[model samples]
Target: MLVTPLTKLLGIRVPVVQGGMQWVGLPPLVAAVSNGGGLGILTALTQPNPEALRQAIRETHKLTSKPFGVNITLLPTINPPDYEGYARAAIEEGVRIFETAGNSPGKLIRYFKQNGCIVIHKCTTIRHAKSAIRLGVDVVSVDGFECAGHPGEEDIGGLVLLARAAQELNIPYIASGGVADGRGLAAVLALGAAGANMGTRFMCTVEAPIHQNIKEKIVASNEQDTVHIFRTLHNTARVFKNKVSTEVVAIERKPGGAKFEDVRELVSGARGKQVYETGDPDYGIWSAGVSVGLIKDIPTCEELLARMEKEAEDVIDGLVKVRVEKAKL
Candidate 1:
């Protein structure tokens, strides 16, 4: 059986994790991943309020008796949801695993630990990972520049970033961004990561709640089909290369950079939700990673995970054979 620090920590059979994807991490997909022998995460803020989040968690529990997690991304907004309330609800609902992103959880990390929850913080830079470690997170999920959504301001790819993490991190950590197949899983494991956290790959799965058209677009698009917006604003986001995203880039390139207001209407979260619900890929700006190129079909979560596990086994065995030949030389 494939196993690692992550598998042991999360009590799962495989080391694959479906990272939280906003608007996509509903119960259907989350439960599927957990049932398939991987960790699945539900997006907290995707619910309207803390109460809604509690219901979502309960619903996921009904779907799968296996372990699943909740993702509560702390973004800086004018009016924020009750972060503490959300944590309390998850704790009350018996959720023991959490994936936090965007901003640091600060004292909430302490609260979660106190409540017997395993905290996994997602970050893009080694410095940020160190900070989370100091803050007492059980695990760190490091994202590379090839990741969707916010990859931070650093442009480090998984190859160098993960190797660097292997060298520096003290606790168990996972590799996020651009990992779509078993080869990617084998690569990260070789680089010293405990597991692989996949967002785009999960999004393209049959169990993912997004529309099939969006999945098809991802399968058809290549690595270069993604463009980064808000680079000038210092909060760059990787999104699918569509008409709306291209226009956002065009506006960002012209003059002294684009303001949030300049493209606010175009990048609306509601519109992105419509794209997912309506199956119109070009209807709005949606997030996707460079791993889109690696996706070719929409398979069930179980099928996908089983294939990845076999592929990883084969790759590792092939590498061992290569090492044996080298030793003979």
Candidate 2:
């Protein structure tokens, strides 16, 4: 495969990026993705403290010599959560890449650049992508409505979002959301994106730290199985359809009966931790992209990458063959 600016900037062999999934991007998982030829990312906030994040970075370094990154989500509600401290710690640990999500990165982007780390901020809309570019980020990871986590209220899909970003932004960017296979990858590339950032797809990989049961659930899911909840909070998350999420939606729709605090218990962060770690799907939160339906089997990071590359090559070649046949006519 031809190396793009994304691979060159990150110093990785492939353009694919392992999305920083909370509770899933541990040291072993991050190292595995890096070793498998993609830019692995550790979710920094998953660590209980800044010291724990430092330790995870050290462990990832011990596992692979390849490049990797750390993701820090700037949630505004957390009062003085020491986000800058975490960013400084990641820099001191020699992390070459940083993926920022959530609220405005603002000064954090300047800080990362000053520390000699390339910043890639995940944005759900073209406006946010422009903001990241204005903040001087090297790359942008555009997460469309089909992505897991907070897909924003605009609900724009990847194809339209990527094209819009390409038209408006000068900086190199990657397409995310609803991308899980080689065809998805080729489609993103053809859409003018430098590469694809995969979250749910990587979650099903063997290297992912989530329980095997969760991986199985992801594989078994179809496009119709996901539901977006918490829109009343102005924070929408795409979760696999379950009893809990269904109830959440139900409560939100009730006339003069639903309260944000009422559904808060069901969407607690601790509950998500339990579900992701213990595989107790019934009691905790399970995030999945609409692309989960397309996933049929669980594969190792290596196998997934190899298969995606081969299938993408076949797709590109097939397109060329069609063009050649047309010329003969």
Candidate 3:
């Protein structure tokens, strides 16, 4: 078995955690991952209110008795929802796991801990990881530049980031960004991570609520099919290459440069949600990681996670045999 600190901590059989993609972390997908022995996550702000989130949690419970988490990314939104209310709603529903990202997890950390919830904070740099550790977060999810969402300004890849984090971090961390299949999971284990956390990889799953055309687009994409936008704003996001995204990039690269308002309409969350519904890859800005290149087929979460687990075992067995052969020589 491929056991790690994450598996023990979350009480999950597999160490994998699905990314909390906005508009994509519906109950069906989350429950599927949980039922498949991995940790599924519900995006908090996806619901219109705390009551709606409560219903979603209850719905997920109906599907799987396994553990799942609610992700509440505390970012700067034009009209922010009641973030704490959503967290409390989940807490009241007996949810024990919390995945927090963006600006600061300071306030929510205290509440989560007081309620005996396990907090896994996502960070793109070593300093932020250290900060999360200092704040007593139970786990850290280290995201690299290849991550679909905000990858921070440093732009370091998973190999360098995960290796460095493994050497320095006293707490256990999982590798995020550019992870897709069992090979990626095995690579992260070698780099000292407990497991792999995938966003773009999960986007191609059969259970993903997004349109099938979007999944097909992801499968068709290569590594170079993604582009980095909002770099000038220092809030860099890696997304699939599409017409709207291309326009945003063009505006950002203008001679005089562009402002936040310049691309606000083109990159709004509503537009992205529409893209998810319509299956039009070129409709709006949507996050996709470099790992989209690694996706070749759409499988049910059960099939995907199970295959990865078997492949991980095979990889470890192969390595052990090689070591034995070398020792004999």
Identify the candidate with maximal lDDT: 1
Instruction: Give the clash count for model 3.
Output: 0
TM-score of candidate 1 relative to the true fold: 0.98
Residue range 1-329, candidate 3, lDDT tens digits: 78899999998988899989999999999999999989999998889899999999999999999999999999787787798899999999989999999877888888999999999999999999999988889999999988998999998999999999987899999999988988889889989999889888888999999999999998888889999999888888888889998999999999988999999999998999998899888889999998988999999999999999988888877887876444564
State the lDDT of candidate 1 residue by residue for 297-325, as single tens digits: 99999999999999999999999887644
By TM-score, the candidates rank as 1, 3, 2
Q: Which ten residues in a row have the lowest lDDT in candidate 1?
A: 320-329
Clashes of 1: 0
Q: What is the lDDT of residue 224 in candidate 2?
A: 97
Residue pairs with backbone atoms closer than 3 Å in model 2 (clashes): none
Candidate 1 CA-lDDT value: 0.93
TM-score of each: 0.98, 0.96, 0.97
Indicate the residue-level lDDT of 72 in model 3. Answer: 95
Instruction: Score residue 322 of candidate 3 by CA lDDT.
Output: 72
Candidate with more favorable, higher TM-score: 1 or 2: 1
